[model samples]
Target: MTAAKKAQGPVLTTRALNRATLERQLLLRRHTMKPADAVAHLLGLQAQNVKPPYYALAARLDGFEPEEFSALMASRELVRIVTMRSTIHTHTADDALALRGLVQPARTRELNMFRKGLAGVDLDQLVVRAKELVEERPRTLKEIREALLERWPDADPQALGIAARCSLPLVQVTPRGLWRQSGQVSLTTLTHWLGRDDGQEAVPDETVLRYLAAFGPASVKDFQTWAGLTRMREVFERLRPGLLTFRDEHGVELFDLPDAPRPDADTPAPARLLPEFDNLLLSHADRTRVVPPEYKGRTWLGNFAWSVFLVDGFLAGVWKLAEDKESSTITFETFGKLTKAQRTELDAEAVRLLEGPLGTGLPYDIRYEKVVGA
Candidate 1:
């Protein structure tokens, strides 16, 4: 049904919202598309750490091999950069450029958060010197901070580093993101890394459309939360006529692309493992559409976010992996009871995760532990 027509339709249940988002995120089924294509489809993967994108893609793509994704990074086809919400993410090169431009306003807001630390430093000169240093050679944040200290000895070193990151479109260099390859996080401008002479600015209208396509049937608050920008209601209002609109169970208006997928609520959703800080858990304001209320506030402990997995398409539990010379063990700590069938399905999925995506030759075991506070 057209988005306009759907406006007058029955209210969408939580399960219906869950299934539709899973379908768009490629979590409903593993797709055979190339990693780059998948990255584009989902906008990009939340890649604050090196391994999440690998794990994220492995869960969504059929027959995914880490080397295929690694090759994209090695060849500069895919890039790791700080974009949405000023968090590092892995994006296709084209998206790295376009999205960096689109989210510049958010990055500016991020800089404002550190303004007290940046006192007494010339922000304009800081961007110039930092850019020159990074473009000359990809420098670690430490290296950049120490160098900046030479010019602004009294300014907060950490803030200088953050200001440099916020002001410039810095991309985390390759070896840092390459699968199984470990390296320090280093930086260079997107222009320097991609060798593009064209303007990096993106049209805001196109950005809004892309957001809806990936995470939509969503509200203006959801978009603002995901993008870390404010006053986006005006943007959504301007695009309202051409877009589809629907009220969630709470009567929040959701806007979506007319042709985007919205699957039946009863569609079967498989159990799947997800890495820490996965976008599925972080991208929406009304996360009730994906995360159960009982599981809320449980995934994070202090500053570390635990990896989680889905059972019946909702956040079921936290997971941890321990590997030895002989075998790899995946431990699921559940918040509630699971049926025999659910346990069996999770076991089978865990086996596939170890042997298929992780490429571990060692024997594996899946074990369950009682939730700590349950």
Candidate 2:
């Protein structure tokens, strides 16, 4: 049977959806939530690299200091582990332990893509040896690879090392994930980081339910896509009676918690500077709500991708900051003609951003130039 389609209440124009997303993602304005709280509320932050999220948070959270997040890792309240879509994400320690088991299947599939390099290598035995090597003490990436070569001498040791790290519930140690610093990859057991004996247990449905609680009123596909799990349609069906469903105009189903913020389509949104690869941009399948169609080619740049200006919620244009020894100037180039007043407001926001948060310390000089024939 086709799912129920409630009458469209207010057609949230693309701009309206963009604003709502910015508000929810904390990009519309800097907020005061602690790093751990912020990570928990957003489910997790995209942490492909460590420093990016620190800067990303700094841009969004008021008075955000790097140590605020670094301390969480030190306290074992938060952990840097492989979770959520089998990508590197920084999540609460409790969530890390609970969700690791749930996403293992996805991890295994991803790990296999590099398996040709591990041909004739025994993976089951490798995990045992890999765990033994790290259990005694943390080891740097090179050290781990050298030790693994003892068991699989002919195998590509680097590939072997990466596979073992992902297969096992290993957490990348800090200084590795520290803010404003660069460090070598190091391996330590997740159990060691969290200081818990229950690391081996299978995560239960409550963990999946927690994802639903935050990003819900969503379909099983959305859940699996975000969490990087599979064979979970049954899970969504099981949870169906407890969720609220609505079909978008395209007939694709969307699910969310009944009480979650599906705010009015007309809610006012402000200009935002989003970090590259912000969760707000990467979290969805349908991006029409935030990125304009014509600007897609520019947003998905060929070589140089800069942080974007989300004006009135949707991405309006691209902005870049460049500096010589004496001064820094922000340049704005829009896809279409801007009214004189709009151009003025954009220039003001750019000045505030470079000086206010980035603290470039150089003088602020802003300029606007239209794309010829645009």
Candidate 3:
């Protein structure tokens, strides 16, 4: 029976898959990657909030400083834009242009869903006018809403603004995503921000290869979930010749790049503190490899995703940070118990976080609760 299974091919257990994912995510060990380079490699960091991307790079990169990333935002080398999953992501300037076009069909579907609110509004005219408003100068959503209302006063005020977002490749300008800075979400076209007229669109076939390089051993369903697109099985089939295949323990077929790293099942993975909505947990349809089944729903609270912590490359706990004018404190609350040695390692990691990217120019401390909610 063992020989028969071997003849079929290797079956990757959950642990093996977890290690491989961590390595690709740069969570297995800290790397000395440049800010723009890392953003391009991870596809982009989930930037729903300003600090998550900074805190994320802190945990994944060696000797990372917040200013290193913030400078990229200021230079227009990296941008915060609505792209994958229809959520704001910190993407490279090139990606901001290409991916916007790649996922445009999904955005069109999103705009169509609000047609009831846009009964008389012409989407083609809306796109042209929105491009003018933002390219003239960055405009806040309130400004855009009011501008649209002038043209379509009876249209649902909120829906008009959302429709504009869905139809345009708007980017959130600097000082909003810059580290240790605050500003309202102001917008502009990617072309205006990057100072280039022509941008190459992201080839979906090429994207499959890039996705596999960073988040592979994935199924077509997993890629679809991450890209927020569908009908990708055809693409996968086309690329199958250059890929390798293996079955997950559940017999689900997984595809990976031929030379991508596939770590052994028992490889050591240190504790990692990940930002809220990190792709490591969200990029796959079946999350069991990174999120143990029992901990389902623990990392979220009524639509909010808390920053999470990993012990041995699996979701073990949730963490929160509290700050005042004088000091900052980070608290850890694990869903499962840890060994004495594990506790020691986590303590050190928490301190590493305080000293690194989170250097808020204030005194710092760490705290641990006996239970997750306590």
Task: Encode model 3's per-residue lDDT on 1-374: one tens digit a residue.
Answer: 34225225578899999988888988899999987888889999999999999888888888888897899899988999999899999998888898999998888888878889999888889888888999999999999999989999999988889888998889999899987789999998888988995779999999998998888788889999999999998898878777788888998888889899999889899988888999898999989989999898888888799999999999988888888899888888888778988778888887887766576668888887756352
Q: How far is candidate 2 from the true structure (C-alpha RMSD, Å)?
A: 3.6
The lDDT per prediction is 0.87, 0.69, 0.87
In the range 1-374, model 2's lDDT, one tens digit per residue, is: 33344323324444545555566677666789888888877777877776557756765788776777887876778777877766678878866776787778887887888898888888988888888888778887688888888778888977887788678988888777865467777778888766785644334455556665544434566667677777876765666666666655455565545565665667766665565566666566666667777777565666335566666677777676677778888777776877676776676667556666454578878876665555
Q: Which stretches of candidate 3 lie over 4 Å from their true place?
A: 1-8, 370-374
**Could you estimate the TM-score for every candidate?**
0.95, 0.82, 0.96
lDDT of 1 at 6: 49
Off by over 4 Å in 1: 1-9
lDDT of 1 by residue, 124-204 (tens): 999999999999999999999999999999889899998999899898987999887899899999889989847556677
Clashing pairs in 1: none
| Model 3 TM-score on a 0 to 1 scale | 0.96
Record all residue pairs in model 2 with backbone atoms less than 3 Å apart, i.e. clashing: 85-227, 216-255, 216-256, 216-257, 217-255, 217-256, 217-257, 218-255, 218-256
Clashes of each: 0, 9, 0
- In model 3, how many backbone clashes occur? 0
